[model samples]
Each structure stands twice: as structure tokens, then as C-alpha cells.
Target: SIEIGENEESAMCIGVAILDDLSYPIAAISLSAPEQRQSDELIESAGIALMAAGRKISEQMATG
Candidate 1:
């Protein structure tokens, strides 16, 4: 799960869920910017990146 917060007038800080095997978010990634450029596109790209990151992490944990 990812949460976005309007922390500033020109940016939104997003908190990403970093989970463990238990399906709980044990960590997170936060980022902010001066408004989202082409929000739809940015969101899609971010989704892909997060999914890839999550999959890689899961694979590493299962193997190591």
C-alpha cells in the first residue's frame, strides 16, 4: 500500500509500503516533489517500479 500526503504547497510526499513475509509493511519509502508531472504517467511508472522492487526483494528473501 502506498499513501500520499500533501506536505507542501508544491509537492506530495508518498509513503510506500515495504513488507515482510507476514504481509506487513516493515519499512517505507517517502518522496516529494514540486507537483507530480503528468500524474497519471508518473503514477503508472511508479507502480511498475514498486512492483519490480517488491518482487526482487521477495525473491532475495526466499533464496537468502
Candidate 2:
């Protein structure tokens, strides 16, 4: 299990990774903020995006 966030002053992204027993990431989320938008609000917004990403990946893997 891992969570990573990147803030480049102007832009930011939040990421989360769920690893398998073998330490391979089974699912992951990567969210990007709007241009020149780096703040607590942006982070909060990214969380929702990341959550959707993670769920989408998990569903794809489950079906495939």
C-alpha cells in the first residue's frame, strides 16, 4: 500500500497504489490538478479523481 503526492508549486497530483502479495501494484490512481492550481482545495479535488481512477482500474482488472 502506498500513497504519493506531487506538488510542483503550480500543479499537483495525488496518487495511490494497492500492491499485491508479490509487491506488484494491482491497481493505481494518478490525478492531475489544473494549471497553476496547487492548494489544499486542489488536493481535495485530486483525491476524488484518484479514487475514481483506482476503482476503474480495479474493475477493468476484475473483468479482464
Give per-model TM-scores: 0.60, 0.51
Looking at candidate 2, what is the lDDT of residue 13?
Answer: 56
Residue pairs in candidate 1 whose N, alpha carbon or C atoms collide under 3 angstroms: none
Clashes of each: 0, 0
So what's the TM-score on candidate 2?
Answer: 0.51
RMSD list, candidates in order: 2.7, 4.5
- Candidate 1: which stretches are off by over 4 Å? 1-5
The lDDT per prediction is: 0.61, 0.60
**How high is the lDDT of residue 45 in model 2?**
68
Q: In candidate 1, what are the lDDT values of residues 1-64, reduced to their tens digit?
A: 4334544655655455666776776665555555645385786677678667866775566457
Q: State, as a TM-score between 0 and 1, how close model 1 is to the true structure.
A: 0.60
